[model samples]
Target: MNPTRHAVSLGLRRGWTEFVLSLRSPQDQGFYLFMGVGTLAYLWFNRDTELEGTGLLLPTFALPSILGALIAFGVVIGPAYALAMEREDGTLLRHKALPHGMQGYVTGQLLYHSLGLLPLLLVILVPSFLLFDDVMSNGAAGWATVAWVLVLGLLATLPLGMIIGSVVPSVQKVGTWGMLPIITLSAISGIFFPIQAMWGWLQAVAQVFPIYWIGLGMRSAFLPDAAVTVELGDSWRTGTTVLVLAAWAVFGMLVTPRVLRRMARRQSGSQVQQAKEAALQWVR
Candidate 1:
């Protein structure tokens, strides 16, 4: 087998193994439960409320947008934290010593994080259908849209996480460098409210990021045609969503490897030791 392919295969296996382990881990289980329960509770409380004009139930409008936000949040923050912690613990350095190891390592990270979405989605989506009516309006076509949007959203957002991880000085910094920015984006991206309600410039800023497009794409999938009136331009802008997400995916493909390689090159025993010492001190 070609060396890169072999490395990729190994990476895929490693990712799968990690994901399986996470499923069994109590900590991960708690996280899944918390997110699922929290989201369901929010939707449930708002179940009876209707959108001011559309007469659509709040849950019907919110579920898909929440899904999109979660996708962007999970992919981006999960990888960022993983990469940062692994870097501090010498994982990156260990991988750097092997032939085509980085490739495998990256492959593993991508697969692990991507698979992580399933349980999260299932936790929310399964109950959502039971708790809310018309959560999925378009049926088969809606599901098809979901499939494509999810693929594109992952491509677009996962790399940003990796890049943030590769660049942040330490795992602790991920909150400021990665999490805060994404949270800010989510607030402006129409996850909780309509984007059209924001100022014109803020709307433009929100549209520039993948989170907004991801949420928009998701809403397009789960929402009926009439829901478009609540969206910007009073349209789902399906073509624009596709183009924007694809653009981000392309950017990530072109940029993430270079950023990772540069970060990897800088890793050394001394740096790892320093990080460990710093962590110990912080813990103290």
Candidate 2:
């Protein structure tokens, strides 16, 4: 096998192990659950406005999209930060020096987080059904939308998380800064209100990233055809979003090796020590 493929396979196996760890990992899981709940509650409170008087309709559309955005980012960001910290600590160097080390390192994170959001999605989904059973059942299309968003959200967030984590200083900053894009993008993506309210120039900025398109994809999935609001108008919005995200994924794949190489080449012993001490204090 090619060294890259071999490394990815090993990383995937290790990442799978870590995925199980994430299941048992409290802080990581909490990171996801907290936002999932917060999003659900926030949307529930404003259900009427977003839903336009359809209270029961909120969960079907709202919960999954929010949870997908929240949890998917959570899943990727934490592990990436952890990996970076390890890199800072010189563990990544040790691993990287190993045959296929870099590949394994990245693959472990990707695979571990891939299906990691499933349980959390279920957690968000079931209660949503309990509370908004009528609305959810009413729109079969909505359910389909929810499922699709969750899937695409996974695809979008996982690689993006890898990109973010590759350079982030530590896990602490990951929580602080990493979550910002997802949250900010969610707003831009039309999750909070409508991105349509913004000027075209700003709207153009929002769409520069995948958040708006992903949110639009989610919007299409969850709301009925009539209730659905696709603020950013692209005739082939879904296909476009998929293409954009896939392009990013490819970009991430291509750039990650170079980024890793650059990060490795630039890192020195003292800086790493200083980084670890700072990380420990911050974590504590």
Candidate 3:
């Protein structure tokens, strides 16, 4: 087998192993439970409320949007924290010492993060379907739309996470640089409510980012065609959604490799030691 291909194969296995381990970890299990319960509770509490014009209940309106937000949140922050922590813990350094190591490392991250979404989505979606009515409109066609939106959203946003991880100084900084911004974006991305209610300028700003588009695509997938009246200009804007997400995907493909290479070039034993010391202090 080719060296690069061999490395990528190993990385794929590594990702699968990590996912299995995460499933067995009590902390991860608790996290899944907590998020699923919390989201379901919110939707349940507001289940009877109807949107002013859409005639859809709160859960039906919010479920797909929340799923989209979760997708963006998980893909972006997962790799950011992982890369930062791995960089400090000597994982990246170890890989750097091997030939074609970066290729393998990137592959592992992509696979791991992609697989990571499965449990997250399942934890929320399976129960959601049971508890909510009319949560999926258009049946199989809606599911097909969901599949494409997820694929495009992942392609557009995963690279941004990798870039953030490569650039941040330490794992500690991920909260400020990664978590904060993502949370803010989620709030403004129409996950909790319709973006139509926001100020015009805020809506414009939200449109510039992938989070809003992802949520929009997801809403289009789950909501009935009549619900489009609640969206901006009473249309789904499907063309714009595809165009914007594709642009981000192209940009990430162009930029992430160069950023990773630059970050790898700077890794040194001394920095890893300092990171270890800092981590120890944090633990204490």
Best by TM-score: 1
Clashes of each: 0, 3, 0
Give a tens-digit lDDT track for model 3, residues 115-208. 8888889989999999989999988989999999999999999999999999999998999999999999899888898998899998988999
Candidate 3, lDDT over the whole model:
0.92
Candidate 1 has what TM-score? 0.99
- Note the residue pairs that clash in candidate 3: none
Decoy 2 TM-score against native: 0.79
In candidate 1 the C-alpha lDDT for residue 234 amounts to 89
**Clash-forming residue pairs, model 1:** none
Q: Candidate 1: which stretches are off by over 4 Å?
A: none
- Cα RMSD to native, each candidate? 0.7, 3.6, 1.0
Worst-scoring 10-residue span by lDDT in model 3:
10-19
Give the poorly placed runs of model 2, Cα more than 4 Å off: 1-6, 47-50, 53-61, 134-155, 169-177, 233-236, 267-271, 280-284
Q: lDDT tens digits, residues 1-284, model 1?
A: 89999999999999999999999999999999999999999999999998989989999999999999999999999999999999999998999999999999999999999999999999999999887889999999999999999999999999999999999999999999999999999999999888888999999999999999999999999999998899978889899999999999999999999999899999999999999999999999
For model 2, which pairs clash?
Answer: 11-108, 15-108, 145-221
